[model samples]
Target chain A: MENQKERTTIVLFSGELDKAIAAFIIANGAAAYDHEVTIFFTFWGLNTLRKDEAVNVKKGFLEKAFGWMMPRGPGKLGLSKMNFAGMGPQMIKHVMKKHNALSLPQLIELAQEQGVKLVACTMTMDLLGLQEEELIDDIEYAGVAAYLGDASQAKVNLFI
Target chain B: MENQKERTTIVLFSGELDKAIAAFIIANGAAAYDHEVTIFFTFWGLNTLRKDEAVNVKKGFLEKAFGWMMPRGPGKLGLSKMNFAGMGPQMIKHVMKKHNALSLPQLIELAQEQGVKLVACTMTMDLLGLQEEELIDDIEYAGVAAYLGDASQAKVNLFI
Candidate 1:
């Protein structure tokens, strides 16, 4: 096994704050264990990679509505549970900070620092009418085939 | 590497319908690939294992309130998103049926039939005021140590 390279692939399918945090935590943990970690963000998960500032891009009505209704970035994501009209996430974040836990953005930065590869799904971007400029810098872009190529070789593949 | 055992451990931490479906889907997929898969249900995830029938168990005010607020079993669990005051889950279920996808209960049965080990977290059971008789039969029960023991040797470890 010493000659074998360990790899972990995570298909991040959820854009909720807690789920995104879990994905990054797992990716960072795998990287710490000396495994090559790749996270493929698709559909709603792409919101995590979106830039906080709204980009000036032209789009159809529905696409623009989606862009407006959905969370713009990690900071704007709502909690999967107890989201009492958007107040639950803020309360949770406060509790997390009180306990000295890393914020979701901090976790993303840490994962990147630990060499965890972040890949945005190009198909999802197209469907959502998201331009590359609307996303954060320092990330890769690919489709599902590229993700499956990595997943096929990974000993651990998760759809989160 | 050829001689190594392929083990996958999943920590089911959320009780939401969508998350539970994802867990079973992943568990079944791993089993299809001949991996030894274990799903440890903890905290809210234990709600998935609850029987649809309400058990006659006495509890304190807070515990009774907790039980009342949370969904009783997999059949009653809500979706993680688009839950429009409970209508969204039914809508999603209808769509899944239309697409010939298995319901959450069917997925659970399939996963078990495929030899996925379903383990209930004993600590969570105690914390949530749940009893052994309230859950489905033929599943294992243990603490975090047992889960960590499996996760340590497993090639894939996920907290869903």
Candidate 2:
């Protein structure tokens, strides 16, 4: 018998790795329930979708001045905030390696394995001067209109 | 010289246990960082604040049609979603137990221990016909205006 599937869609608007991780966790959790899931990555969230650009953790005083103190790319995230303090970023790297939850890369791999749809926001790409070739191959391009269409039909719509 | 303190706040928007667990995780994570944290429960998220209500796990057709289920209260959630697969709720119950993650009750207890704020939504209470007496002892009442006023000054405002 064919099973009826429920759709879960989320519009993720984050450029930070930590924020991205939060969205991915929820997506993965919902997918585990066998729901058809779609994630629309807009604004900063689109950075993780870049194919050639490595997810770099931000660093240094200048970056920190601009609120870039968190790890440069998607490589550093997931330690509970309390655990993040005291331990240097290097230690975080080691722990993440041990736990296998290292940033967007692992999340991307997991999302692919779990069949979560990845959509990039064209508006963000244009604003960031990102070309279509810059995004990861697994990603599909969609404008806000397309994303809204998907979101309208979803049983659950989340903005994170 | 006295230093400025970093503020912490967690906003929980979902009535479900898994969503509630995410809030607990973030709340505890903040508390671990020695930041003053607050958890604002609003709308459907009020399910966690209901002292008499237990966690609702979706059992297949039998439980859905009938009311037979496990985990007497919110404290019992995450059990089925964690490990149970074959024996119905039993598999879920086992998986959650393996992780030692906080159940709703335990999470509430931990919030108490950590001095995490548990703010109940005033409007939701009136809408749902919930009285103050129906809630747990640690709850406080705040309107949406109050929550947003505080959230504006907060470094992080999460809707979980």
What would the TM-scores of all predictions be?
0.66, 0.44
Please give the CA lDDT of all the candidate structures.
Answer: 0.84, 0.61
> Judged by DockQ, which candidate is best?
1
Q: Where is model 2 more than 4 Å wrong at Cα? A: A1-159, B53-73, B76-92
Clashes of each: 0, 22
For model 2 chain B, where is the 10-residue window of minimal lDDT? B79-88
- As a whole number from 0 to 100, the lDDT of residue B117 in candidate 2 is 80
Candidate DockQ scores, in order: 0.11, 0.02
Q: Write the per-residue lDDT of candidate 2 for residues B32-86, one digit (tens) a residue.
A: 6665678898776776776665335434564333222322236444411112333
**Residue pairs clashing, model 1:** none
DockQ of 2: 0.02
lDDT of 1 by residue, A52-156 (tens): 998998887646866887799999998778878789989989999999989999998988898899999885576556888999888999975566557656788
Worst 10 residues of 1 chain A by lDDT: A144-153
Candidate 1: C-alpha RMSD after superposition: 6.3
Error of 1 at B35 (Å): 0.8
